[model samples]
Target chain A: MKLSKLAMVTVAAAMVGGTPALADLVFPSLSYRTGPYAAGGIPFADGYADYFTLLNERDGGINGVEARVLECETGYNTQKGVECYESTKGEGSLLYQPLSTGITYQLIPKATADGIPVHSMGYGRTSAANGKIFSHVFNYPGTYWDAASIIVNHILDENGGDVKGKKIALVYHNSAYGKEPIRTLEELAKKHGYELTLIPVDHPGQEQKSQWLQIRRERPDYVLMWGWGVMNQVAIKEAANIRFPMENFIGVWWSASENDVLPAGEGANGYKAVTFHGVGSDFPVFDDIKKHVVDTGKAAGAGDQIGTVLYNRGLYAAMLAAEAARTAQALHNTKDLTPAQMRDGMEALKIDAARLEELGLPGFGPEINVSCENHGGPGLGAIQQWNASDGTWTLINDFGPADRAVIDPLIMEDSLAFAKENNIPERCN
Target chain B: MSPDFLNFIETVLNGLMTGVMYSLVALGFVLIFKASGIFNFAQGVMALFAALTLVGLQTGQVPFAHLINAVLGTDVHHWGPGLPTVLAILVTMLVMIALAFLIEKVVLKHLVNQEPIILFMATIGLAYFLEGTGDLMWGADVKALDVGLPSGGSFWWEDVTRNWAPAGSDYFGMYIDTLDVSAAIIAVVLVVALTLFSQYTATGRALRAVADDHQAALSVGISLRSIWVIVWSIAGFVALVAGIMWGAKSGVQFSLSLIALKALPVLILGGFTSIPGAIVGGLIIGVGEKLAEAYVGPLVGGAVENWFAYMVALAFLLFRPQGLYGEKIIERI
Candidate 1:
């Protein structure tokens, strides 16, 4: 053998053999703590990190293995996100939770190629629900398609099971993340007779005067928004400016943060958004987090965003990842897990109501069960309304299923097209 | 009497109002550009930093609290009870003045007699540095700025205008944001004050002379360094006003810096050196973009206002390169 090749082989073997048995399970957080979207990203990054800290402090770790978070700031830019992914993926990274839809879309094929699982949870390409096509990408609990259907269902419920001839407008950000729900919404609009108006707001959406003005002129019965960052704040403010009923205004999960509504003050009262999880710091897990993670000064960022909406999401994502790690440990009969083993555990992961109660997050979110054929959990969501007076988002409805009749077909078509285009064979079969 | 006509008028009125908000930002750019030949790219970042300082001071937030906490392993966030809005604004003005002095000494002083592009590049660096420093000091969280500005629609005007629509027509009323109305009034006061300052005061005359010719102004016994500091301070104060209005409209956040994007087209169409042109150019772009978005946007996929302003600016550049009120660029060939 050549000297260089022999030396490389010896070094590789020794490194593999010398790898420590107690190495921490790595979770790379593609966080954007600086940028226009920092307001939304800060709380989320805090929550994610704090949850891992909680696991370390309160429970020793997930199944006796310490969980370490590798944070790389993306600045909410897609290129920066990809750069973060490349730089962090080599750190024995088990999974990725790219909070941005643009980043998630870019990471899907790349992560799949790298044998790592990406849990885009409630965001990203909705078709990833079809695990047959996208075995590595999981947007469990809910997808944008599910959120759209859930929103339509809530609207339908409000109108006594009918929204015939009613006008509904969608004020969406002009990007892939914003466009994900349009197809599902269109299908639902056809299934149930309703007029749909589409208004696209460009990125950063600092100015939406023209859009709100159009909404006023058209006077849609309900205005559904798919906005993020400052777009949400400006839209809510402009809606209030035009005297639009705050009750009729709804946003996607990304748009439901405190930053979005606090700017408009009392004017944002009664603003509703569809969420897959609970809001506020009422959960028992928060008490544990405060005691073990925050009070000890071992918290993530500031330690002030303990129970905010995005913070809770980050904590929930960590909990899911930790649970998946435990599941992987048990299935493989080993604590040291490979990224592929993590994918296996994620596929077989099941978090029932009892499991949630045991985890001290009772009634916080829908039960999730992952299988080979289903990467996205039972697509369920609830409606949350902002009460500007008390400064809290109250769950206005029970967690319910999305309109599967409309969503299933769309998912099938999109995923099938993606599978064909990428030459990816069905994996579940 | 036609509801469509009323809607058209309403669009124009709202357009004019939105235009005034754009002018608020553009005025700062014109102030700096007229006094010195540098197009201040940091004007938007200055507004963001000023608003952050105002919010931080009002809330009694300890400066660099996050960094301090991170470094010292402490949990300090606020220092004491919040300050009153007026007191906070006054304190914030002083901070902006100090920042102006520092910029003149540190950045502008060193870049004197350099190429205009070099000065512009310096402002870009200044913008990024200010944004990062603001984040490090106050943290990146969004904060609400009240300043007691009345927001939401003017109900009295809406009610009165509602009767103008046909009795049975769908046009409910003309919707105008009270905040936008207040911004227009403030913008007018600002422009008048600036005109009076430059046309009346000794320092203002020195500023105009410097804008006319930096070397000549220096030769005529005007202190160039003092003039730069004075103009930058005035620009900083203008940024504060713009910050208050925009911050009140939308919570003070990092996106406040992106308002510079909204001002770019206005600066292009309204000559780079004319304060009056900033206002007129803002109105033209605002009305034109709003009308296009309202009428032509629906036909095309909508969101045309994003680029419609730039398209108008491009057309203006094609016809009148110096802009409506910009001095004609004369060269001795």
Candidate 2:
């Protein structure tokens, strides 16, 4: 009877074109590998899949339970993202990493209702970091608000702790992701005594003649950007064209990829961006990925994306999820885990300096400690500058702290408002 | 000059340059519409594909490397050293010409004598197919197009204009991109070349005959299929030039296709049947939108440029449906 059941299971799996077995841990990657933003999305998806492949190959499927990445293309469309989520959530999907902020916003409430944890990483609704209100969503390691605060702190450090009467301009993509830092920056402006200018770039951001011309006319002391995909590249080129001092212009983490800078050639030199993790292929984990995944012909997409900025971010996200799963396994003492179990694992997860060192990434990222109340980790980040000649990004500072004094109240206000509107009861006791 | 006046002058100059860029894409649309009367929605995608092909050839990247690797489990990215920029461009032009032939034979040929809307739908389908095929041929990474085009601000112009302002004024200098200037020059050259060809060449006369009336031209010795292939090939070459300029400016990527939308207002303003109309319309829309965004956007929360062109087009549509230079429409009672 057992032999016949095994045969029947194998046949069923074969009939499905060799889909992952139902028993494996499922991580659905809602990726956009086509459309305007595909330049950024392709590497990220490759990195996400390759990291999971590494876990399965090198570690024998995360402590004897295999992991499967079910990727669905969203083309960066929010509607398609929801469809991908709905389609893949039934495959025992433990977590979701919807890279697009728009898709993450759409998936937050639905994934919450479905009891699936979403890890938005560096991008998403800022208030989702307040785990008390957003129970199933986590934007750990850093949030947009945290990045905003961190950038302000860096600027303050550069200016000898004073920016009174200084004009600081923000050139942002006119979307939810771009609008995220406005409130925080306004608050920071009130505290620091700097004049604020807001410039919104529409989707795709291919043309910015008027905005850059305005920048030239106004001549602000510094510029901050919240852009993604083609917007980043175009903005950098335009900034270079207007002779905007490259060092004075900084981008959010999403805007700091190789794809963004490489298009500008030497013009992108000295461009700075906030980063939560280390860049390049100097990390030891890439060695194992090469041995087990790329060389073995099990890599995702093209193998050329192993060391890119977004790729590293995707790998970092997968690393966090795997660590959380291992933590859940230890807590429950079981190899087979459910979605709820995965949520519990993510909540109780902690990665310290020692743990990072052991994971073959000694200084790859900040120490993440997720909890019931604080889902956004320590909110730490650093600055990375582009060296156009060598085609490399050098981290300019160590992981510094975000201004929690200003950030916490705003988070509280936003989370409480969200809780009241959604009628969600605060969870963590 | 007053600082405010200098700023206005700067804005206008930049707008004109931006308009020239829009006109480059609009010319392709005008060519197809003038000849075939099919609103080729795929013009933007054609530019994107042409640019992608140029970059792929320049970098010597193996076509369909991803698909091949997936199916055969083989790692093959590049065959050998890349071709020179000029050689790659020539090869890309040939590829685009071949693509034009294939499109005429496979898509446009079957839809002959069909309604304009049907042909338009076919072009839409062709656009999507071409976009997908381009992605498969060249990986979707953003590749920098280096045709040795000098970009950044014109320092000489800036230095000359810096002293135009009063001694105490905060205005540093007028900002103008050298690449935009190059694009303007190239666009003028393209327009002149197109005009000379249409006026002097036999094929160009044949093209003009078809544009006058497709059925009438078919009644004569003109082969409508051959005219389409030729016009499309010319449009394809125009797309290659536009793609190179744009791809150089913003890097060759998918958003290059969205530029076709920017040309829509130009088409509406400049009658779609006139090449010079496209250029003039592009300039009007470009300057009008830039000035609107600069002077009025701040008062109304900014980002008005994205919609300002459409508003101008809408006004033109309501007042003069045929546009500034479009052939006057006369309907029989």
Of the candidates shown, which would achieve the greatest lDDT relative to the real structure? 2
In candidate 1, which residue ranges exceed 4 Å CA deviation? A1-20
Q: What lDDT does the true structure give each of the candidates?
A: 0.91, 0.92
DockQ of each: 0.83, 0.82
Give per-residue lDDT, candidate 1, residue A300: 82
| Candidate 2: share of reference interface contacts reproduced | 0.87
Model 2 residue runs over 4 Å out of place are A1-22, B72-74
lDDT of 1 by residue, A1-429 (tens): 699999999888978898555889999999999988898898999999998999899888888789999999999999999999999999999999988888998999999999999999989888999999998999998999999999999999999999999999999999888988898888888889999999999977988888988898889999999998889999999998887899888898998999999999988999999998988898899999989987888888777897799999998998899999989999999998889999999998999999999998999999899998888899999999999999999999999999888888889999999999999999877
Q: Write the per-residue lDDT of candidate 2 for residues B1-333, one digit (tens) a residue.
A: 998899899999999999999999999999999999989999999999999999898889999998998888787899878899999989999998999899999999998889999999999999899999999989889999988888998999999999999998786888889999999999999999999999999999999999998888889889999999999999999999999988988899998999999999999999999999999999999899899999899999888887999999999999999999999879999
- Could you tell me every candidate's TM-score relative to the true structure? 0.96, 0.96
Score residue A183 of candidate 1 by CA lDDT. Answer: 88
**Model 2: what is its DockQ?**
0.82
Candidate 2 lDDT over A1-429, as tens digits, reads 999999999898798885444378889999989999898898889988999999899888988788999999999999999999999999999999988888998999899999999999998889888999999999999999999989999999999999999999999999888999999999999999999999998877888988888888888999999998788999999998887899999999999999999998888999999999998999889999999999888888768888889899989999999999999989898877888999999999999989998888889999889999999899999999999999999999999999999999999999999999989899988
Query: Between which residue pairs do clashes occur in model 1?
Result: none
* Model 2 Cα shift for residue B6 (angstroms): 1.0
| Per-prediction tally of clashes | 0, 0
